[model samples]
Target chain A: MKIKLVFVSLVSFVAIAFLIYQWWPSPERAIKNRLGGLAKTLSVPANDGDLGRVTRVAELRHYFAQDVRVRAGASGPEITSRDALLGLIGAWTPPPGGWTIEFVDVQVTLGQQATSARVYLTAKVSGHDARTSEPTLDAREANFSMAKQDGDWVVTSVEAAETLQRPGSQD
Target chain B: MKRLLFGSNARLSLLRAAVLVVTAVVVFGYVLLPVRLQGISMLPTYRDGMLNFANRAALWWREPARGDVVAIRMAGPRVLYVKRIVGLPRERVEIAMGVVIVDSVPLIEPTVVYKAPWNLPAFTLGDDEYLVIGDNRVMAMENHDFGRATRDRIVGKMLF
Candidate 1:
């Protein structure tokens, strides 16, 4: 009887363990998917007042409880929600120049507060410029922070890394 | 024979440990975790990081009443937001500056607050929309889309 009881309990335990392990990470993934989808809506080319929405979007990250920080490769003024839109305005006046950029990899960690995501990607630039005669290539790793307001997710800030100079190209 | 008995016991113990860990994670990850994660934002009554219960089942028994605080899901596909219920669906909501008058009666705002800049009108709310604004109007609270939190998105009310 004693041996039979032990065997029964062990089998039951294994069954329970298998069930929980399979569904455990769902809520976290749900939150991430929600935040990411909302972010995609705001990822259009920065335009007039669009930056304000971006600021509010950035503020969403704070709900996840992380601070926002940003690092950029191009030598330009820091982009704010308003600035992002204004930058486009400035870019469009004479259409200064256009560049192609994509985040290589972005990992967003969703939690109560202090939410942060790391983004990796490359940018291809090609246009008439006083800076960089040819198409300059730059890669970066950026960390984004998320937060909450009322009861929604916001991107409070971002921190991006600076890329080093090419092997032989330092004038 | 002795080795067989010991080996089986050890395997059983390992299985038990695995079960305990998994059970803890489910209870912690789903039910307990969301409760603790839900919190009061920017209000003195509910301090920052204070965990609050959500009464989603309440809606099943009765219609959501006026002045009850609710956790609403915003339009951003996957966003979960909380706010005080100021207007019922289809009720005409009017706002001037930061104050709200629903059916011409002043609705009591939540202890935690915000006001959107854009005058949140009844039209802005698509059929299932609920107009909820924060009490603190400092952060462009008086003019923004945060007010038009939809009803279908509401998870439940905040349990104080």
Candidate 2:
């Protein structure tokens, strides 16, 4: 009877341990959470003035590596230097009133060595143009290559992958 | 009455449940894996949102034959593609006038829906490579991401 009780107890303990292990959060999940937070932070506008632009650039720079290359649109040339990329972003003047951007459907895939990852996300930007107050809706997918530095994931490059929907191809 | 709470019947029941759980894990994880279709690439045959099973045990016993629908792993095991195998290892494949040519012989694909023109140059597969393509050939060739599926990349054959 005592031997049977010990065997049952051992099995129960093992099953519970296995369940816990399955439910535990992994490194991949942690990296995904970081990327999501960064994407959300990027959507916020900082085109109020020079200070606002500076703050925005700083916040954006925090999520990127020292040597980052950014390619805005599908046919846009690659911005090799990080400073040049920031300057290009700073040059953009916000539409008269303001704008809002949201990132959705974020998917992150860790590389074979876990030192790098590719993040696929959809960005929706909506606002009115300064010249024309017509509200505009633009959606695009951004594929980001991230590298791990000092134990923190940082964006190394960004490429506009594809449009969420083809133009006039609703069918 | 206290011993009755943990009697032979209760122990047997617990053992049965454990056996059932183990069997399910082994069968689903290693033998019969479930996959869900995501795009119109395999339209008319395996539509989007359809669910099916891939038999891994079949591949273990025999080589994957031509015209067999297979699941290929992409971006790791989480993302997979369901495509029909048209070219075997070390075979030359080409797409001409919406027809698939293997070793200079045009294949008779009854289920193929050709709405777009395709004129791709012939390419030879590697020793352990197999060419795969979707049944919906109507889509533009540039949009379709079909090519050689290595031996290790093919997960298994579709059950149905």
Candidate closest to the true structure, highest DockQ: 2
lDDT of 1 by residue, A1-171 (tens): 787788789889988999887667653444455555644443333232545444655544433333233335334355455345333433442213434344333454546543433322222222333364343332334455555455555555555532222111221
Per-residue lDDT, model 2, residue B157, is 93
Query: Docking category for candidate 2?
Result: incorrect
Write down the TM-score of every candidate.
0.40, 0.63
lDDT scores in order: 0.48, 0.75
Specify the highest-TM-score model's number: 2
lDDT of 1 by residue, B64-101 (tens): 66667666532221223445566667776676565676
| lDDT (tens digit, per residue) of candidate 2 on B1-160 | 7556546686686677779899999998878888877667787899766899888887997888898999876433444668888889888878787888899999888777654787777877778878788888887887875777778878889999
Model 1 chain A, TM-score vs. native = 0.38
Q: Which ten contiguous residues of candidate 2 chain B have the minimum total lDDT? A: B72-81
Q: Write out the backbone clash pairs for model 2.
A: none
Give the local distance difference test score of model 1. Answer: 0.48
Docking class of 1: incorrect
DockQ, prediction 1: 0.01
